[model samples]
Target: MLSLQDYSARDALDLAGLVRSGEVTAAEVRQTALVAAASVESRLAAFTEGPFEQLPAHSSGEFAGVPFVIKDLLITAVGVCGHGGSAALADAAPAEADSTLMRRFRAAGLGLLGTTKSSEFGLSVAADQKWRGPTRNPWDPQRSPGGSSGGSAALVAAGVVPVAHANDGAGSIRIPAAHTGLVGLKPSRGRVPLGPWQQELMYGNVVEFAVTRTVRDTAYLLDLVQGNAPGEKYGAPLPAEPYRDEIADRSPRQLRIAVAAHGWDGQALSPDVRNAIELTASTLADLGHVVEEASPAVDWEGFLAALTTTWCAGTAAAVVPLLKSGTDRDLFEATTVTCAEVGQALNPVDLAVAFDQYNALSQSFGSFHAQWDLWVTPTSVGPAPAIGDFDADNPQYTAAEWVRRCVVPYPTCATSNVTGGPAITLPLAQTADGLPLGVQLSADLYREDIVLRTAAQLERALPWAGRRPVVHVTTETRQR
Candidate 1:
C-alpha cells in the first residue's frame, strides 16, 4: 500500500511511473487517493461531487493510475453533472456523454474521480459561493485558494491530487495557482479544445488546462490533451515539438525578457509580491537572459469596460434561460442577477464594439511581444485574501462595480486572455509567512513553448518542492 507521505511526495507523472513499473497497482493508488481526500474534506470544501463508489473507468496511458477532478464549470464528464456550485442549477441533470476535454482526459489514462467547486458560473475570483459557502485555501484555511478554480487549487495544493482540471477566463486557473503554490498554464486559445458542445467561451477569452505541482506535469498534460476538436472555430498553432521535450533543455536559449515589477494598471503590489517579482527578474538575469523593466501600452480603462460589457452579456445569456424556466431569481446570486440584467440591456452594437476592442488589444500585444520575448509580473497583488474579502452575494454592487472591486485587483491576468496568447503562473516565490506568490510569464499567441521552457528553467533554479500547505495530506496524516 502507498502511504500518505509517499503518495503526497510523488506527482502525477511519478505515480504513473510507479503504476507502469508494477510497483503498485492502479487500484491501490486510487484507494490511497480516496483516503487522502477523505482526510481533508472538512478543512477544504473543494468538491461539488464525489470520491464516488466507482469513478468512470480509465485505460492505461501516461497517467494511467493518477486520480483527477474537473472544475464544476465548462468541462463535463459522463454521469457527473456539475452544478457549478450554484443553487440555481442544484437539480441539473447529469451529462449524457463526455465533453471533448473529458474524453481526452480519460484517454490520457487519468482516473476521472469527481468534480470540484466553482464560483456560481465562475463569476468571481473568490470561490465564496453564497449557497455552498467558501472553498478554503490549503495554505491558510481562513483565506481563499483563488477561483473560480478554487476547489481544484485546494485539492492540488493539499496533495490530494498532484494535478486537476482548471480553466481561465480572467485568471481562474492562474489566480488560484498563484495563491496555492501550483503551476497553472492558461494555454493559447484553442490549444486545448472545448468542443462538440460549443466553440469558444467568454468570446475566445477563456481556455482550459489544469493546475499541477510541477512544470513537467503541466507540460506533459498539455501534450496529452491539446489539439483542436472537430469543427472547432479557432485553432492555435501546433507545438514545434512535444511540450515535454521542449522543457527538457537546461540551457534554454537566452532571450530578451521584459519585467513588470510594478502592476500595469498602477495598483499597488504588496511588499512580498514586489520582492518576488524583483527576485525572479534577478534570477532570470543571472541565468543569462536580458531582463529589463517594460510594459505593453494598453488602454486600461477601455479594456476593462469592454470586458465588463462582454462578461455581463454572457452572464445574462446563461441566466435568463433559467429564469424563464421558472427557476426562482433568488436562487441565483444577487451579483449574477445584476450582471445578467446589465447584459440583457446591452444593444448588439455594444457587444460588437467590445469584440473590436479585443482585436485592437490583440494587435497591441503582438507589437509589444515583437520587442520582448516574454513578460513577467506578479500573478496577484498579494497572496490569497481572507475568506470574507470578496462578497459575491452583496446586492449593493452593480455589475461594473463588482468587476472593479473583485477583478481589477489582479490586473495582469486578463491581458493574455484578451490577446489569445499563452500565459503561465509558476510558484517561483513565497511570502515570509509561507503563502505562495506566483510570477507570471506570458508570450504572444501560440507561443506556449517559450512559456513552458522558461517556467521549467525557473522550477529547476528556484524549486518549490519542499513547500507544503498546512492542510496537506502528509501533514494531516502524520498528525493523526
Candidate 2:
C-alpha cells in the first residue's frame, strides 16, 4: 500500500531502486509524487498547473521509473501552456510536442510530474509574480527561495521531489540551490541540447540542467540529455563513458584548486560566505588537494557592462514579439518593463561591442584555467535576503540602484556564465541562523565530468546529505 505521499520521502535513485527491487511500482511513485506535490502546492505555489500525468510509458535508462518535475519555462507536456511566470503569455498554447530535453528525459525513464514556476521571462533573481504571488521558501516562508528557478528549488528542498529541472542564465539554479541547500550545477554551454526552437538563449550564456539532491543524479541526467539536437549550432564533445561511471570510480588524485574569497567585481565577501569558502578550501587541502587563494585578473566593470548589454538585448528580443502581438503591454513587474526599455535602446554596434568584450573576458579566463585545474569561490556574496528585497514596485530605489543592492558581489556566479565554463554550487556551509551557504567550484570548459567527480568526492568527505532543513515536512504530515 505504498501511497502517493511516500514518493517525497526518498530521492530519485531510492525510488528507482524500490521499483527495481519490487518494493514499489512506478505508478505508486507517481501517485506519491502527485500527492506530495498537492500537499505543498498551495503553500509554496511552486507549480503552475496540475501534478500532471506520468509519462505514457517507461523507457530504458538508469532513472527508469523515477518521478520528477520540469520548470514551466521548458517545454514538457504538449498543450500544457507555460507562462514562464508572466501574465502576458497567460493564453499561450501548449507546445505541440516535447522539447528535445523532454524527449531525453522520458527516454531515460523519468516520469514527468508537472511544471514549476519561474521569474517572468526568467529575468529576475526573485521568483515573485504579480499574478501568482511569490514562491515561498520552504525553510522560511518569509524569505526568498531564490530565482528564476525558485519554484524548482523550493519543491526539491521542501522534500516534494528528489530533483527537478532548473536552468541558469545568471545564478538562477545556483542561487536557489544555495538558498535551499540543494546541489545545483550549471553545465558548460552547449553541453545540453536546446532544439526544435533555438541553439542558445541569452546570447550563449544560458543553459539547461537539473537541481538535484545528489551529485550522481545531476551527473546521470547530464549524460542522458547532452548532445546537439537536429538544428543546434554546436554541442559539447561526448564523454568516452557515462557520467555515472565517473562518479562511481573515485580516484584520489591531487587537484590544483585556486580559491577566491572576493567576488569578480572585488566586492567584499560577507564573513559567513567567506568563512564557507575558507572552510571548503581547508577541507580540500586536508583531502590532499593543492589549494591557494588566487583568481585570474578580470576587468570587472567591463564584464558587468557586457553582461547587462547581452541580457538587455535578449530581453528586448523576447518582448518585441510580445509587443507586436499586443502582449507586451501586459507585463506586471516594473523591472521587466525597465529591462525591455533598456534593451531597446541598444543598437547593433553596441551589441557587437558587448559581444567582443564578452569574448575578451572569456579568453582571459581560458588563460587562467591553463594554470589551475579548478577555481573555488563563494556562490553568493552573502546569505539569502528577506522577501521583497528586490521588489521592483518599491520606490525606495531606482531600478539601477535596486539591482546594485540586490546583486552584491557582482559577477560572483555570473562569471562562469561569461566564461562558458562548467560550475557547481555545493551546500557545504550554513549561517549562524541555519541558512545554507554554498561554495562554488568551477573547471575549464567542457570539464563537467571532472567538476562532478570532484563534487562527489567532496560530498562523501563532508556528508551534507544528512543535513535537513529545520523547516520541513513533519512525520505527522507525511503520515497523513
Candidate 3:
C-alpha cells in the first residue's frame, strides 16, 4: 500500500520516476490517489466527486503517469461534468471530446482523477459553497481556503495531490495559494490556450494555470501547456526555451525591486502580512537586489470602479443563460444574484468606459514596470479569514464592502490581470499564528521566466514544500 503523505508531496517527476523504476505501476498510482482522495474528500470537501476510473493512456511526456485533478470550471476527461460549482449546471454533460487544454494535459502524461470544487461561476474569493458546503482550509478547517480555486488549493495543501489546475481572473490562483501555502503562477493572459467554443478574450483578464507545492512543478507545467492551439485567437509569444530551464539556472540579474505591503487603493494591511512583505524585502536586499518603496501612478478610485464594472458585466454575461433557462432559481448564493443584477444594470456606455479605464491602467502599470524590474507585495492584506468572514448574509456591511475589505491585496494581483503580466505567489513566510503568509512577486508582461526564476531562488532560500497541512491523510489514517 502506498502512503498518502508520500503520494501527496511527491512531485510529478518523482511519480514518473516511480513508474520508470518499477517501484509503482501507473495503475498503482491511480489507486493510491483514489485512496487518498476518498479518505480526505468528506473532511476537506475539496473534490466534487469521488474516485473516477477510465484514465487515458500514459503519454511519453515528462510528467507521464502522474495523477491529478482539474478544477470543475474547466472541461477535462470524458464523462466529467464541469458544474462550475453551481446547482444549475449540476447535471450538465461532458463535451463530445476533450478541450484543447485537456488534450495537452493528457499528452503530457497526467491521469485525471476527478473534478475539484470551485466557487459558483468562479465569482467569490471564498470557497464556501451554498450547495456542497464550504471547502475548509486544511491549515484550519474553520478558516476559508480561498477561491474560486479553493478546492485545488485545499487538495494540494492537504496532501491529496501534488498539483491541480487553477485559473485566475480576480486573483483566484494567488488568493487560495496565499491561504493554503503553495506556489501559484498566474501566467500572462493568453499564455495558455482556451479553445473550441470561445475565441476572443473572455473579460480580458482571466488566465488559467496550475497551483503546485514546488516551483519546478509549476515551471514544468507552464512549459508544457503554453503555446497556440490550432484555432486560438492569439497566443503569447513563446519563451526562447522551456520555463523548466529557468528553474535550474535560477539566478535573475540583481533587480530593482519595489515593496508595498499595503493595498494600492489605501487599505491597511494586517501586521502579520506587512511583516511578511518587509521580510521578503530584506531577503531580496541581502541577495543584492535593490529594494525601495514605490507606488504606480494611476487614479486608484477610477481604476477600481472600472474593474468592478467590467467584472459585473462579465457576471451578467454568465447569468443570462441561466436566467433564460429559468435556472436562476437554482443559483447557489445571493451574492451571485446581486452581482448578476449589477451587471445587467450596466449599459454599453458603462462597458466602453470600463475598457478605456483598463487600457489606461495597463499603460500606468507599464510605466511602473519601466521603473522597476519587479514589484513585491503581500498576497493578501491579512491572514486567511475565518470561513464566515466574507459572509453574504451579513447585514452590517454590503457585499461590495466585504469584498473590498477582505481582498485588500487585490491591486497587487489585479494589475497583472489587466496588464497581462506574469505574477507569482510564493509560500516563503509564515504568520505567528502558524498560518501561511505568501508574498506576491510580479514582473512586466511576458516576463514569466523572470518571475519564475525569482521564485526558484526564493524556494531554495526558504524551502516550503516540506511544510504540509496538519489535517492530511497520514499512514496512520490510511491503515483504517
Best by TM-score: 1
Q: What are the per-model numbers of colliding residue pairs?
A: 0, 2, 0
Q: Write the per-residue lDDT of candidate 3 for residues 1-480, one digit (tens) a residue.
A: 566767776887788888878898888888788778777777788888655876558688778778888888865556677788888788888757888888888888887887888888787788877778788888888898988899999988877778788988879999999899999999987888877666643376888889988898999988888988777775799898789888885456888988887866677877888888888888888878899998677787777777777776777788776887788555546766666777888898988998898889889889999999888987887778788766643435443554464345555777788888999999988888789988999989899988988888888777886786767767326556
Task: Report the C-alpha lDDT of model 2 over 293-409, residue by residue, as the tens digit.
Answer: 899887777766787777777877888778776775656566666766778888989888888888888898899899899999888877776777767545354445544544554
- Candidate models: Cα lDDT each: 0.90, 0.79, 0.80
- Candidate 2 residues lying further than 4 Å off, grouped into runs, are 3-6, 53-55, 328-330, 393-406, 475-480
In TM-score terms, candidate 1 sits at 0.99
Off by over 4 Å in 1: 55-58
Query: For residue 388, what is the lDDT in candidate 1?
Result: 74
Candidate 1 lDDT (Cα, whole model)?
A: 0.90
Model 2 weakest 10-residue run by lDDT: 470-479
* Displacement of the residue 161 alpha carbon in candidate 2, Å: 1.1
